[model samples]
Target: MNLIKTLIFDFGDVFINLDKEGAMANALEIFEVDTFPEELTHVNCRYEMGLITTKAFLEFYATKFPNLTQGTILHAWNCILRDFPKHRLAFLKKLQAEKKYNLILLSNTNELHIDWIKNEIPFYEEFKSCFNRFYLSHEINLRKPNSNIYEFVLTENNLTPSECLFVDDLKENTDSASKLGINTWNINPETDDVTQLFDVNKRLF
Candidate 1:
Protein backbone atom coordinates (compact mmCIF):
# COMPACT_ATOMS: atom_id res chain seq x y z
CA MET A 1 0.00 0.00 0.00
CA ASN A 2 3.00 2.28 -0.42
CA LEU A 3 1.52 4.71 -2.89
CA ILE A 4 0.65 2.26 -5.61
CA LYS A 5 0.81 3.83 -9.09
CA THR A 6 0.25 0.70 -11.18
CA LEU A 7 -2.25 -2.15 -11.18
CA ILE A 8 -1.37 -5.47 -12.80
CA PHE A 9 -4.32 -7.76 -13.30
CA ASP A 10 -4.86 -11.38 -14.19
CA PHE A 11 -7.42 -11.92 -16.95
CA GLY A 12 -8.99 -15.26 -16.07
CA ASP A 13 -11.11 -15.36 -12.88
CA VAL A 14 -10.39 -11.65 -12.38
CA PHE A 15 -12.36 -10.03 -15.19
CA ILE A 16 -13.43 -12.99 -17.27
CA ASN A 17 -15.01 -15.82 -15.27
CA LEU A 18 -13.69 -19.34 -15.70
CA ASP A 19 -15.12 -22.80 -15.14
CA LYS A 20 -11.87 -24.46 -14.04
CA GLU A 21 -13.29 -27.37 -12.10
CA GLY A 22 -16.09 -27.92 -14.56
CA ALA A 23 -13.66 -27.84 -17.45
CA MET A 24 -11.40 -30.32 -15.74
CA ALA A 25 -14.23 -32.69 -14.95
CA ASN A 26 -15.53 -32.47 -18.51
CA ALA A 27 -12.10 -33.22 -19.97
CA LEU A 28 -11.53 -36.07 -17.54
CA GLU A 29 -14.82 -37.65 -18.50
CA ILE A 30 -14.06 -37.30 -22.18
CA PHE A 31 -10.47 -38.53 -21.90
CA GLU A 32 -11.43 -41.39 -19.56
CA VAL A 33 -8.81 -40.28 -17.07
CA ASP A 34 -9.16 -39.46 -13.40
CA THR A 35 -6.41 -36.82 -13.57
CA PHE A 36 -4.44 -35.17 -16.34
CA PRO A 37 -1.35 -37.04 -17.33
CA GLU A 38 2.02 -35.33 -16.97
CA GLU A 39 2.64 -35.19 -20.73
CA LEU A 40 -0.72 -33.56 -21.34
CA THR A 41 0.05 -30.86 -18.78
CA HIS A 42 3.55 -30.41 -20.22
CA VAL A 43 2.16 -29.88 -23.68
CA ASN A 44 -0.38 -27.42 -22.31
CA CYS A 45 2.33 -25.45 -20.50
CA ARG A 46 4.36 -25.34 -23.72
CA TYR A 47 1.28 -24.14 -25.57
CA GLU A 48 0.57 -21.46 -23.00
CA MET A 49 4.20 -20.32 -23.08
CA GLY A 50 4.13 -20.10 -26.88
CA LEU A 51 6.69 -22.84 -27.38
CA ILE A 52 4.13 -24.79 -29.45
CA THR A 53 1.94 -23.71 -32.32
CA THR A 54 -1.89 -24.08 -32.33
CA LYS A 55 -1.70 -26.91 -34.85
CA ALA A 56 0.97 -28.66 -32.77
CA PHE A 57 -1.07 -28.28 -29.60
CA LEU A 58 -4.19 -29.77 -31.16
CA GLU A 59 -2.22 -32.54 -32.85
CA PHE A 60 -0.56 -33.49 -29.58
CA TYR A 61 -3.92 -33.98 -27.90
CA ALA A 62 -5.44 -35.72 -30.89
CA THR A 63 -2.49 -38.05 -31.21
CA LYS A 64 -2.39 -38.84 -27.51
CA PHE A 65 -6.13 -39.40 -27.30
CA PRO A 66 -6.27 -41.10 -30.68
CA ASN A 67 -9.92 -41.99 -30.24
CA LEU A 68 -10.83 -38.29 -30.10
CA THR A 69 -10.58 -35.80 -32.92
CA GLN A 70 -8.83 -32.40 -32.88
CA GLY A 71 -12.16 -30.58 -32.74
CA THR A 72 -13.19 -32.50 -29.64
CA ILE A 73 -9.90 -31.64 -27.94
CA LEU A 74 -10.27 -27.97 -28.91
CA HIS A 75 -13.77 -27.85 -27.41
CA ALA A 76 -12.60 -29.43 -24.15
CA TRP A 77 -9.68 -26.99 -23.89
CA ASN A 78 -11.80 -23.88 -24.50
CA CYS A 79 -14.59 -24.92 -22.10
CA ILE A 80 -12.57 -23.43 -19.23
CA LEU A 81 -13.25 -19.88 -20.38
CA ARG A 82 -16.63 -18.35 -19.54
CA ASP A 83 -18.19 -14.89 -19.36
CA PHE A 84 -16.38 -11.55 -19.30
CA PRO A 85 -18.71 -9.37 -17.28
CA LYS A 86 -19.67 -5.96 -18.63
CA HIS A 87 -19.45 -4.56 -15.10
CA ARG A 88 -15.78 -5.51 -14.93
CA LEU A 89 -15.14 -3.71 -18.21
CA ALA A 90 -16.95 -0.66 -16.81
CA PHE A 91 -14.82 -0.77 -13.69
CA LEU A 92 -11.66 -0.88 -15.81
CA LYS A 93 -12.77 1.99 -18.03
CA LYS A 94 -13.58 4.04 -14.93
CA LEU A 95 -10.08 3.42 -13.61
CA GLN A 96 -8.60 4.49 -16.93
CA ALA A 97 -10.61 7.72 -16.92
CA GLU A 98 -9.31 8.67 -13.51
CA LYS A 99 -5.72 8.34 -14.81
CA LYS A 100 -4.50 7.80 -11.25
CA TYR A 101 -2.66 4.58 -11.98
CA ASN A 102 -1.17 2.62 -14.88
CA LEU A 103 -3.32 -0.40 -15.76
CA ILE A 104 -1.73 -3.58 -17.06
CA LEU A 105 -3.20 -6.91 -18.08
CA LEU A 106 -0.99 -9.98 -17.75
CA SER A 107 -2.67 -13.21 -18.68
CA ASN A 108 -1.62 -16.81 -19.27
CA THR A 109 -3.65 -17.18 -22.46
CA ASN A 110 -3.25 -18.93 -25.77
CA GLU A 111 -4.30 -18.42 -29.41
CA LEU A 112 -7.42 -20.58 -29.46
CA HIS A 113 -8.85 -19.21 -26.22
CA ILE A 114 -8.31 -15.60 -27.26
CA ASP A 115 -9.74 -16.22 -30.74
CA TRP A 116 -12.88 -17.58 -29.07
CA ILE A 117 -13.06 -14.57 -26.77
CA LYS A 118 -12.74 -12.14 -29.67
CA ASN A 119 -15.67 -13.80 -31.43
CA GLU A 120 -17.83 -14.10 -28.31
CA ILE A 121 -17.16 -10.73 -26.69
CA PRO A 122 -18.03 -7.84 -28.98
CA PHE A 123 -16.42 -5.28 -26.67
CA TYR A 124 -13.15 -7.14 -26.30
CA GLU A 125 -11.10 -4.42 -27.98
CA GLU A 126 -12.68 -1.70 -25.85
CA PHE A 127 -11.86 -3.70 -22.72
CA LYS A 128 -8.25 -4.11 -23.85
CA SER A 129 -7.93 -0.43 -24.67
CA CYS A 130 -8.44 0.46 -20.99
CA PHE A 131 -5.07 -1.03 -20.14
CA ASN A 132 -1.74 0.72 -20.65
CA ARG A 133 -0.18 -2.60 -21.54
CA PHE A 134 -1.95 -5.80 -22.49
CA TYR A 135 0.26 -8.88 -22.30
CA LEU A 136 -0.71 -12.41 -23.19
CA SER A 137 1.61 -15.17 -22.03
CA HIS A 138 1.75 -16.77 -25.43
CA GLU A 139 2.70 -13.46 -26.98
CA ILE A 140 5.29 -12.70 -24.32
CA ASN A 141 6.65 -16.24 -24.16
CA LEU A 142 6.35 -16.12 -20.41
CA ARG A 143 3.82 -17.42 -17.86
CA LYS A 144 3.22 -16.59 -14.22
CA PRO A 145 4.10 -18.51 -11.03
CA ASN A 146 7.56 -17.94 -12.47
CA SER A 147 9.37 -14.96 -10.96
CA ASN A 148 10.99 -13.99 -14.26
CA ILE A 149 7.63 -13.08 -15.77
CA TYR A 150 7.00 -10.52 -13.02
CA GLU A 151 10.55 -9.27 -13.40
CA PHE A 152 10.02 -8.88 -17.12
CA VAL A 153 6.97 -6.71 -16.57
CA LEU A 154 8.73 -4.58 -13.98
CA THR A 155 11.81 -4.13 -16.08
CA GLU A 156 9.92 -3.41 -19.29
CA ASN A 157 7.71 -0.80 -17.64
CA ASN A 158 10.49 0.65 -15.45
CA LEU A 159 8.21 0.03 -12.47
CA THR A 160 9.10 -0.40 -8.86
CA PRO A 161 7.44 -3.48 -7.41
CA SER A 162 6.73 -1.67 -4.13
CA GLU A 163 4.59 0.86 -5.96
CA CYS A 164 2.50 -1.72 -7.88
CA LEU A 165 -0.47 -3.89 -6.96
CA PHE A 166 -1.15 -7.21 -8.65
CA VAL A 167 -4.67 -8.61 -8.43
CA ASP A 168 -5.11 -12.25 -9.29
CA ASP A 169 -7.49 -15.08 -8.39
CA LEU A 170 -4.71 -17.59 -8.10
CA LYS A 171 -2.80 -17.54 -4.82
CA GLU A 172 0.31 -18.86 -6.51
CA ASN A 173 0.31 -15.98 -8.97
CA THR A 174 -0.18 -13.37 -6.23
CA ASP A 175 2.38 -15.08 -4.03
CA SER A 176 4.94 -14.83 -6.81
CA ALA A 177 4.33 -11.11 -7.07
CA SER A 178 4.45 -10.62 -3.30
CA LYS A 179 7.95 -12.06 -3.25
CA LEU A 180 9.10 -9.17 -5.38
CA GLY A 181 7.60 -6.58 -2.97
CA ILE A 182 4.48 -6.01 -5.05
CA ASN A 183 1.19 -5.44 -3.18
CA THR A 184 -1.23 -8.22 -4.01
CA TRP A 185 -4.82 -9.31 -3.56
CA ASN A 186 -5.43 -12.98 -4.12
CA ILE A 187 -9.07 -12.42 -4.95
CA ASN A 188 -11.73 -15.08 -4.45
CA PRO A 189 -13.85 -15.06 -7.58
CA GLU A 190 -16.85 -16.73 -5.93
CA THR A 191 -17.27 -14.06 -3.22
CA ASP A 192 -15.37 -11.16 -4.69
CA ASP A 193 -16.10 -8.88 -7.65
CA VAL A 194 -13.43 -6.74 -9.33
CA THR A 195 -15.84 -3.76 -9.27
CA GLN A 196 -15.56 -3.75 -5.47
CA LEU A 197 -11.80 -3.16 -5.59
CA PHE A 198 -11.80 0.16 -3.69
CA ASP A 199 -13.81 -1.25 -0.77
CA VAL A 200 -11.99 -4.57 -0.57
CA ASN A 201 -8.49 -3.10 -0.63
CA LYS A 202 -9.30 0.35 0.69
CA ARG A 203 -5.97 0.85 2.47
CA LEU A 204 -4.13 0.73 -0.84
CA PHE A 205 -6.45 3.26 -2.41
Candidate 2:
Protein backbone atom coordinates (compact mmCIF):
# COMPACT_ATOMS: atom_id res chain seq x y z
CA MET A 1 0.00 0.00 0.00
CA ASN A 2 0.96 3.67 -0.04
CA LEU A 3 2.12 3.32 3.56
CA ILE A 4 5.07 1.26 2.38
CA LYS A 5 8.04 3.59 2.12
CA THR A 6 10.89 1.14 2.43
CA LEU A 7 11.40 -2.12 0.54
CA ILE A 8 13.60 -4.58 2.37
CA PHE A 9 14.67 -7.42 0.12
CA ASP A 10 16.36 -10.73 0.90
CA PHE A 11 19.36 -11.61 -1.25
CA GLY A 12 19.60 -15.37 -1.64
CA ASP A 13 16.62 -17.17 -3.15
CA VAL A 14 14.62 -13.99 -3.48
CA PHE A 15 16.95 -12.54 -6.10
CA ILE A 16 19.17 -15.50 -6.97
CA ASN A 17 18.98 -19.27 -7.30
CA LEU A 18 21.00 -21.11 -4.66
CA ASP A 19 22.24 -24.62 -5.38
CA LYS A 20 21.78 -26.19 -1.93
CA GLU A 21 21.56 -29.70 -3.33
CA GLY A 22 24.72 -29.26 -5.32
CA ALA A 23 26.49 -27.81 -2.34
CA MET A 24 25.48 -30.67 -0.06
CA ALA A 25 26.50 -33.27 -2.65
CA ASN A 26 29.84 -31.56 -3.18
CA ALA A 27 30.37 -31.30 0.56
CA LEU A 28 29.72 -34.99 1.00
CA GLU A 29 32.25 -35.93 -1.65
CA ILE A 30 34.97 -33.43 -0.75
CA PHE A 31 34.80 -33.73 3.04
CA GLU A 32 34.89 -37.52 2.66
CA VAL A 33 32.55 -37.45 5.61
CA ASP A 34 29.54 -39.74 5.44
CA THR A 35 27.19 -36.77 5.40
CA PHE A 36 26.53 -33.39 6.89
CA PRO A 37 26.12 -33.98 10.59
CA GLU A 38 23.14 -32.58 12.44
CA GLU A 39 25.53 -30.21 14.11
CA LEU A 40 26.05 -28.62 10.71
CA THR A 41 22.96 -26.45 11.28
CA HIS A 42 24.49 -25.04 14.43
CA VAL A 43 27.81 -24.56 12.67
CA ASN A 44 26.08 -22.74 9.82
CA CYS A 45 24.24 -20.56 12.33
CA ARG A 46 27.55 -19.57 13.87
CA TYR A 47 29.02 -18.87 10.45
CA GLU A 48 26.09 -16.66 9.52
CA MET A 49 26.43 -14.86 12.83
CA GLY A 50 30.05 -14.09 11.85
CA LEU A 51 31.28 -15.99 14.87
CA ILE A 52 33.54 -18.07 12.59
CA THR A 53 35.66 -17.00 9.66
CA THR A 54 35.67 -18.83 6.36
CA LYS A 55 39.00 -20.38 7.21
CA ALA A 56 37.61 -21.50 10.53
CA PHE A 57 34.68 -23.15 8.81
CA LEU A 58 37.00 -24.99 6.47
CA GLU A 59 39.21 -26.06 9.37
CA PHE A 60 36.21 -27.46 11.22
CA TYR A 61 35.22 -29.51 8.21
CA ALA A 62 38.80 -30.61 7.65
CA THR A 63 39.05 -31.73 11.26
CA LYS A 64 36.09 -34.01 10.67
CA PHE A 65 37.67 -35.47 7.57
CA PRO A 66 41.41 -35.58 8.05
CA ASN A 67 42.03 -36.43 4.40
CA LEU A 68 40.17 -33.37 3.15
CA THR A 69 42.28 -30.41 2.17
CA GLN A 70 41.47 -26.78 2.91
CA GLY A 71 40.82 -26.19 -0.77
CA THR A 72 38.39 -29.10 -0.96
CA ILE A 73 36.35 -27.82 1.98
CA LEU A 74 36.34 -24.29 0.66
CA HIS A 75 35.22 -25.45 -2.78
CA ALA A 76 32.48 -27.58 -1.27
CA TRP A 77 31.25 -24.67 0.78
CA ASN A 78 31.13 -22.54 -2.36
CA CYS A 79 29.12 -25.00 -4.39
CA ILE A 80 25.91 -23.10 -3.59
CA LEU A 81 26.99 -20.08 -5.63
CA ARG A 82 24.99 -19.33 -8.77
CA ASP A 83 24.30 -16.59 -11.29
CA PHE A 84 21.88 -13.73 -10.59
CA PRO A 85 19.23 -13.30 -13.25
CA LYS A 86 19.74 -10.21 -15.39
CA HIS A 87 16.02 -9.58 -15.73
CA ARG A 88 15.54 -9.42 -11.96
CA LEU A 89 18.45 -7.02 -11.65
CA ALA A 90 16.95 -4.85 -14.36
CA PHE A 91 13.72 -4.76 -12.39
CA LEU A 92 15.55 -3.67 -9.23
CA LYS A 93 17.41 -1.04 -11.20
CA LYS A 94 14.14 0.23 -12.53
CA LEU A 95 12.79 0.48 -8.98
CA GLN A 96 15.82 2.48 -7.95
CA ALA A 97 15.25 4.84 -10.82
CA GLU A 98 11.65 5.37 -9.73
CA LYS A 99 12.69 6.52 -6.28
CA LYS A 100 9.31 5.59 -4.90
CA TYR A 101 10.76 3.80 -1.91
CA ASN A 102 14.01 3.55 -0.01
CA LEU A 103 15.38 0.21 -1.17
CA ILE A 104 17.43 -1.92 1.20
CA LEU A 105 18.99 -5.36 0.89
CA LEU A 106 18.99 -7.55 4.01
CA SER A 107 20.57 -10.94 3.65
CA ASN A 108 21.94 -13.72 5.85
CA THR A 109 25.08 -14.44 3.88
CA ASN A 110 28.58 -15.66 4.64
CA GLU A 111 31.95 -14.46 3.37
CA LEU A 112 32.62 -17.42 1.09
CA HIS A 113 29.42 -17.03 -0.93
CA ILE A 114 29.88 -13.27 -1.06
CA ASP A 115 33.43 -13.76 -2.34
CA TRP A 116 32.11 -15.95 -5.11
CA ILE A 117 29.60 -13.24 -6.02
CA LYS A 118 32.32 -10.64 -6.27
CA ASN A 119 34.39 -12.84 -8.56
CA GLU A 120 31.70 -14.54 -10.61
CA ILE A 121 29.13 -11.78 -11.09
CA PRO A 122 30.13 -8.95 -13.39
CA PHE A 123 27.20 -6.75 -12.28
CA TYR A 124 27.81 -7.15 -8.59
CA GLU A 125 28.50 -3.44 -8.06
CA GLU A 126 25.60 -2.39 -10.19
CA PHE A 127 23.29 -4.69 -8.29
CA LYS A 128 24.60 -3.34 -5.00
CA SER A 129 24.15 0.26 -6.05
CA CYS A 130 20.41 -0.30 -6.43
CA PHE A 131 19.96 -0.48 -2.66
CA ASN A 132 20.13 2.53 -0.37
CA ARG A 133 21.51 0.22 2.32
CA PHE A 134 22.97 -3.26 2.02
CA TYR A 135 22.99 -5.28 5.23
CA LEU A 136 24.81 -8.58 5.25
CA SER A 137 24.06 -10.79 8.25
CA HIS A 138 27.67 -11.73 8.84
CA GLU A 139 28.78 -8.12 8.63
CA ILE A 140 26.03 -6.99 10.97
CA ASN A 141 26.54 -9.93 13.34
CA LEU A 142 22.82 -10.70 13.07
CA ARG A 143 20.87 -13.22 11.07
CA LYS A 144 17.21 -13.85 10.30
CA PRO A 145 14.73 -14.95 11.32
CA ASN A 146 16.05 -13.44 14.49
CA SER A 147 13.74 -10.75 15.84
CA ASN A 148 16.77 -8.78 16.98
CA ILE A 149 17.83 -8.41 13.41
CA TYR A 150 14.40 -7.11 12.43
CA GLU A 151 14.49 -4.64 15.29
CA PHE A 152 18.03 -3.66 14.38
CA VAL A 153 17.03 -2.83 10.82
CA LEU A 154 14.08 -0.79 11.94
CA THR A 155 16.01 1.11 14.59
CA GLU A 156 19.06 1.68 12.38
CA ASN A 157 17.02 2.88 9.43
CA ASN A 158 14.57 4.89 11.54
CA LEU A 159 11.86 3.03 9.73
CA THR A 160 8.54 2.11 11.30
CA PRO A 161 7.72 -1.53 10.72
CA SER A 162 4.38 -0.56 9.17
CA GLU A 163 6.13 1.52 6.56
CA CYS A 164 8.39 -1.30 5.45
CA LEU A 165 7.70 -4.10 3.01
CA PHE A 166 9.88 -7.16 3.58
CA VAL A 167 10.33 -9.54 0.67
CA ASP A 168 11.95 -12.90 1.23
CA ASP A 169 11.85 -16.49 -0.04
CA LEU A 170 11.78 -17.95 3.43
CA LYS A 171 8.52 -18.04 5.37
CA GLU A 172 10.16 -17.79 8.78
CA ASN A 173 12.13 -14.68 7.92
CA THR A 174 9.08 -12.85 6.61
CA ASP A 175 7.04 -14.10 9.56
CA SER A 176 9.44 -12.43 11.96
CA ALA A 177 9.18 -9.15 10.07
CA SER A 178 5.45 -9.45 9.77
CA LYS A 179 5.10 -9.74 13.52
CA LEU A 180 6.63 -6.29 13.74
CA GLY A 181 3.94 -4.87 11.38
CA ILE A 182 5.94 -4.96 8.15
CA ASN A 183 4.10 -6.03 5.04
CA THR A 184 5.51 -9.30 3.68
CA TRP A 185 5.91 -10.96 0.32
CA ASN A 186 7.09 -14.56 0.32
CA ILE A 187 8.43 -14.78 -3.23
CA ASN A 188 8.78 -18.40 -4.25
CA PRO A 189 11.72 -18.17 -6.62
CA GLU A 190 11.54 -21.82 -7.53
CA THR A 191 8.21 -21.63 -9.39
CA ASP A 192 7.23 -17.98 -9.24
CA ASP A 193 8.84 -15.14 -11.16
CA VAL A 194 9.43 -12.10 -8.92
CA THR A 195 8.79 -9.45 -11.55
CA GLN A 196 5.10 -10.29 -11.61
CA LEU A 197 4.66 -9.12 -8.01
CA PHE A 198 4.12 -5.65 -9.39
CA ASP A 199 4.31 -4.11 -12.81
CA VAL A 200 7.77 -2.64 -13.40
CA ASN A 201 6.28 0.52 -14.88
CA LYS A 202 3.87 1.00 -11.97
CA ARG A 203 6.54 0.42 -9.32
CA LEU A 204 8.82 2.86 -11.11
CA PHE A 205 6.55 5.65 -9.96
Per-residue alpha-carbon lDDT of model 1 for 94-118, expressed as tens digits? 8999999999999999999999999
Tell me model 1's lDDT, rounded to 2 decimals: 0.93
Question: Which parts of model 1 are misplaced by more than 4 Å?
Answer: none
The Cα error of candidate 2 at residue 198, in Å, is 1.6
**Model number with the top TM-score:** 1
Pairs of residues at least 3 apart in sequence or in different chains that clash in candidate 2: none
Q: Quote the lDDT for 79 in model 1.
A: 97
lDDT of 2 by residue, 39-107 (tens): 877998899889998888877877877886777767777778787899999989999999998999999
Q: Please identify model 2 stretches exceeding 4 Å from their true place.
A: 29-35, 199-205
Report lDDT per candidate.
Answer: 0.93, 0.84
